[model samples]
Target: MEEKKFQPYIPADKVVPEFTVFSVILGALLAVLFGGANAYLGLRVGMTVSASIPAAVISMGVIRFIFKRDSILENNMVQTIGSAGESLAAGAIFTMPALFMWAAEGLCDVPSMVEIGLIALCGGVLGIMMMIPLRSALIVKEHGTLGYPEGKACAEVLMAGEEGGAKASTVFWGLGIAAIYKFVADGLKLFPSEVDYTIDAYKGSGFGVDVLPALAGVGYICGPRISSYMFAGSTIAWFVLMPMIALFGSDLVIYPATMSVAELWADGGTWNLWSKFIRYIGAGALAAGGIISLIKSLPMIVRTFVAAFKDYGKGSAGVLRTEQDISMKVVLVVCLAIAVFMWLFPSIPVSFIGALIVLIFGFFFATVSSRMVGLIGSSNNPVSGMAIATLLIATIILKATGSTGASGMVGAIAIGSVICIIAAIAGDTSQDLKTGFLLGATPKKQQYGELIGVCVSAVAIGAILYLLNAAWGFGSEELGAPQAMMMKMVIEGVMGGEMPWALVFTGVFIAVAIEILGLPVLPVAIGIYLPIHLNAGIMLGGLVRLFVEKRKYASEKEKNDSIQSGILYTSGMIAGEGVVGILLAVFAVLNINTDISGIISLGNIGGLAFFAVLLASIIFFCNKGKKAAKN
Candidate 1:
């Protein structure tokens, strides 16, 4: 006889109190809180923590310990709905801030709240709808092969809590430590979170790192391969490309750059060169990688749709809980309606062509995102990379068709915003579905919860974006909005009529070469795009993970257990800093200064010391996890 498949913790026929009134209300509130926190964090650092596990932990504490509720499904529903906030915020922050930056430059009027709200809402809804069809194919069909690490870990947390055997203290400890650290570093300005050093011998070359908890957490979750790829990109740009440009262009006045290289260097430093040229190469590489990735997945896409349609035709009524999804008819109709609205929306610049792009690219990235997170987890998903690709293609098409200047840029950003959110939400939804699958909750109910979360989070995200821009303008040193900067640069380059096509094409060819060598191009290209400092921080996290992995374990189970615990701690750390980051932004907006005169302020030295301390703490946590596994 063939071996049996693993069964869910709860049987399909069993009824549970899920999607209850209390669950919806609590989930909505958490969604708003987490969404706002993520918005603040993303703007400050171009990243957002995964809210699922953190939200699940908090929900369990409140529902089980405080409220005396006993339903695991109810707790699951809360997290499903609440985590949408982070995903939606990530997508919006990556693209929407460009509008605000352009407005500050007098390129166009600031996008109104209604416009922002609609774009995010539509994207979120579309993402959920798009994932509905893929649910059966990816989540159910490939269940064993694709572990969906975060989703499975979340289910484990929920189950352990229900059995009164969960360990949440690690998460709590990380949260407390990170929050206080961020407040001291960022709020009070005790020392810079980012530390840097310029190499006198290498003219334009320099080295630096952001010693923030979230970046480290992201690095650890991404593991060595992806992190290494990113770091490699950074090394190429900072070490090789920067020096080459400084040497060759020292006497030349590059186009789109008004000053000669030597003059620009004396005035603005190496960053001037990176921004004007290196980032174009990075964008080109990222765009090429995205297109290549999309092309490679086309077979999988065709297979998924075929399987989805066949499954839908068989009917889902009274089906097993693990297999059911939102009706295919409803998903199709809703997607169509949203596409129509995008075309008709006055503020959205694209006409029918824009709507078509949204539908096509939105679904394409959504498919890639869901599958990717299944393999790598949400923290590692390259949503911005995909957005970079979309913005490039959209801007090029618009500019070619005579939609130049501010209008073309807005249109490109709008299309990119939708696709970005769609990918983010789709990834989040798939993760939730995986959690539900393992826990034996209703897929349809989880799908509905995702929709509710998206709607509420969309409103909160629009408000938060506007507030952050008002407090400290995007593109300001205060809030770099790095991803938004990249998007804006692409639009300006394409439509503003002075794009550095040579640099961009160089990047594209470089990515092509990398792909031809059978290497992943997106992460490497992104490393090229982002500042070396950020990649250094991420690499440090990856190194820590490598250290943990190098140690011997009694068994694979023990190894997995140790890594899981480390993940939990890091997840908490990311959340802690994010919450504190938001509060700091609020203070800035309220005109409240938080400088403490007597506290230590050793500048870069202080940053290095703090970074060492943070690294030590990570080692401690990893070692503790190993010990716990042995026990």
Candidate 2:
């Protein structure tokens, strides 16, 4: 067997294109829409928009319709710029929402609007700046090491569009289907939006699954490996954990009594015990898994840091040739000034200290995350590792200051989270820029587009947050502050003399154990964070992939061809599902119940039919391609 050779990196100047008015306008609009949507959803559900594919699709559509003369590279540049908002928003959303939860719970005092805004701005800027140093090592030295499917797809689309080929229709069709399905399922209770079912053998077996037609489609897209990991985690939670809880643990109340399925279980008592034990074990497992993964990736992290430092010392003067020296310097200075402004935004005595901490930690984590993304790709960023780092560091800082009260502790955490988010986004954006560079997009134009996108997205996201808060207050009963709750508990316990040192150490020990077992930690951590149903859906997709792969093909080319088609079809499904789920949620929020169950039943049956058709299509395409190759 031959080892796969990596792709070579193209220079920024050679890959990027000149800036244009149309790119700017389109980029700005996309940034706002994508950023706003991501932020809104992240705040509501703790997840952000998958920007790469959507941005590519929108860019292709706009360019084809409005700027027929524009090259695919130009469109890609615009989309790359626009996607920064979503990339940044994803990071911020993950961390920032905790502030609201903490504040509501009297865990900490809330920062003023100015402080909040400044923190957000600083985080965004810092994330972008931090990625500059790692560009060479991650993007250049490790070219093609990270299979950025979305980025690659965007590049392919641009190449096709530039050649005047109409290959974007597939993307558009996928997006349209996704958006409609998401709207109905998420926005309106069109059908029984959530499906609850349970097994009784385990202590606690009852579990609820969202029959998100679109998200299921997304799982298919993510393919078997990722989907399977997710599903395995879910299975542990629902089938193993839930039932165990009902069997052994005490009776517990959960949302929507009508949705609960305790009665269906043969031994609800056994299920209860299992559920309780699993919850504790899951928490431990999550922390353990994160630490284990981080430890495993430590060598790579160190190498990346060393390389980044060396690159930064070399200076941007002679290295970056994509733009004028003066312009690059000006941008750098402006970014620095913004950072200083962020440090001085609040008059609070400790604000400067907070800012300093954010800057230092932001730099370190940004480098780590960027390199990790370059190594393992964004899907496996070890968010748990970052979160744990934040928790421990923040806890120590708060304890030292004796600011363990709700006000001080929450404020500190909010500050830390914002910084972490900024770091994560910066690294991601940097990687995206590398993709643009590879495809011959202009750096300056992409940068400008990104800024515009940020502004638009920030405004849109702010509005969404305001609307959500006003419409439905944040609480356990509502969009439950699970992540926030976890944060607060850590802070209060660690700093307020209720430290779970034993549990923490236990988690660490488990992490080491798992590492020794040679298992990937991310799946375990994710299993710990998300509910069983989500994981199950992911696993189902993986199973489908496994089955598809199991079928024998005549040749290596034929097998590879079949695999690629399966992946594409599955990717379309996931994208479709997520888009539709969001739309459905929106409808539900508007108090529109369209009796979607009847439609959903049809959809369910249709989904099976759709899967069959997709399978057949892949087989046909593979066979046709194989025959064509032979001729």
Instruction: Write model 2 residue lDDT over 104-207, tens digit each, in one string.
Output: 76655554544444555566666766665445445555554544444444454455445432233333344455455555444433434355455433445556
TM-scores for all candidates? 0.87, 0.76
Q: Would you list the C-alpha lDDT of every candidate in the order shown? A: 0.82, 0.54
Q: What is the lDDT of residue 268 in candidate 1?
A: 74
Model 1 local distance difference test score: 0.82
Q: Relative to the unseen true structure, what is the C-alpha lDDT of residue 267 in candidate 1, on a scale of 0 to 100?
A: 81
Write model 1 residue lDDT over 532-601, tens digit each, in one string: 8888988898898898888889988788878877776776676677567656755654668898735667
| Model 2 ranges with Cα > 4 A deviation | 1-18, 91-111, 137-145, 156-196, 206-344, 347-353, 356-389, 423-427, 437-452, 459-464, 476-482, 485-506, 544-555, 574-595, 598-631
Query: Which candidate's TM-score is highest?
Result: 1
